[model samples]
Target: MIVETSPENFQVWVHSSRALSLEEKRMWLERMRSDPAAHPKNRWGRCPGFRNTKEKHRSPTGRFPLARLIWIDWDSQADIPLLVPESKPSLLSHPSRRGSVCHPADPCRYHFKKDNESTTDFAYALSLARRGFSDDQIRQRILSERTDWSNHKGEKESKTTSIAPSVVSNR
Candidate 1:
């Protein structure tokens, strides 16, 4: 089973023991290409407010920089696995490690863990649109998703913390 999620909908496509025909593959690709979010131009659109000379040097790939993968057990008999598309020779190969399972309560339970250290390319782009940082500036401040920063004494913390409304009101 293969699952593809986008801003619009989440769909699961199942394959049996037989391999998909060339035409079938083409059809699936066509559907994906037709989606607005999946379109290469939309996926790589310029950030609203930032200017970065280095970002201009990036290759224009059709795939989004921050696209995430989630695994689910199609057979129900097997465990879900983590998938890294870049490391795989092809999409047909199965992942070696099983990823964290989807919790029953959360619909989107697969936590995305990026292999690289820098901020996700797409996320950096979004931050540029929202906060407007230069290429060098973005590069210097961006941290890996796994990075943990803390504050000592009365100094402000580097990380942004989300506070629930109820919790905030009680303070």
Candidate 2:
């Protein structure tokens, strides 16, 4: 479903974007204001007709909206709302799909502990969470994934049974 519309709107956007330069944006804004459909929006991504390209907003290039053009200020170094826009790549990038079937939930620890892991490792978990899966549901989803754990070892050398511990400890 590759849809190509007027590049005119995109051109105006490219010109006025803060991601480029104030002088350039000003030049474009002034030049395009006269056009009837020159509204600061375009058909891109799952959304369309956005005035800005913030993660919450859409741009002429869809998810690849120019990083600088998003509504946030570059000086502030704000984070764009996380939106991968598509489910296929999202699902395909899962750790399980990549042959690592497990999302290790230690004896008991916060999931963020695995933040340093590959993005693929967190893909499924993140997907579940984003789709409104509860914390327990997300954990269950991870545990349900199949992975070859033959090469790895747990923290304890002793052969102990796996148990789901409450996240909050009494200590």
Candidate 3:
């Protein structure tokens, strides 16, 4: 769930090519090729999807970087994880143990995975939501989902108690 809050300078750098030099253009392309959030194709799509440099280097596998996993829960999720494709991230001042669940603004190096056996990224969780899996099923797959993050901090719904929203919703 990449909520791009790119500053004006970054926006200009991304949308306008006239102000950049040849070297700058090369570097920007390299950056975009390596990073998906800034990649125009990813931004062009309606759903949040995996973006990385895998398509631009290491033999240029013929797949669009934006063609990866799709995450459409960006609008509703209380928190969305952010992953930077850069080799060296800058926002690691306070890294969270939950790698993929980092604050979207805080840059973190998230190793995105496709398998369901071990990997647990919010995007993958959103994928499960898109696939029609129940919230409990997702919770079983990812324990961090225990908190009802959709509600306010003080109004959080607890799953263990009788006041759990799932039970309430059932009623």
- Per-model TM against the reference: 0.18, 0.21, 0.17
Q: Give lDDT tens digits, candidate 1, residues 25-79.
A: 4455565564434432223433322333344334476333332234555554432
Candidate 1 residue 116 Cα shift, in angstroms, is 56
Better of 1 and 3 by lDDT: 3
Scored against the true structure, residue 132 in model 3 reaches a CA lDDT of: 43
Q: Which candidate comes out best when scored by TM-score?
A: 2
- Model 2 TM-score on a 0 to 1 scale: 0.21
The reply for model 1, stretches above 4 Å from the true place, is: 1-15, 31-67, 74-171
Clashing pairs in 1: none
Ranking by lDDT: 3, 2, 1
lDDT of 3 by residue, 91-137 (tens): 76664333333334422213335343233234445444434446565
RMSD per model, one decimal: 21.9, 19.2, 21.7
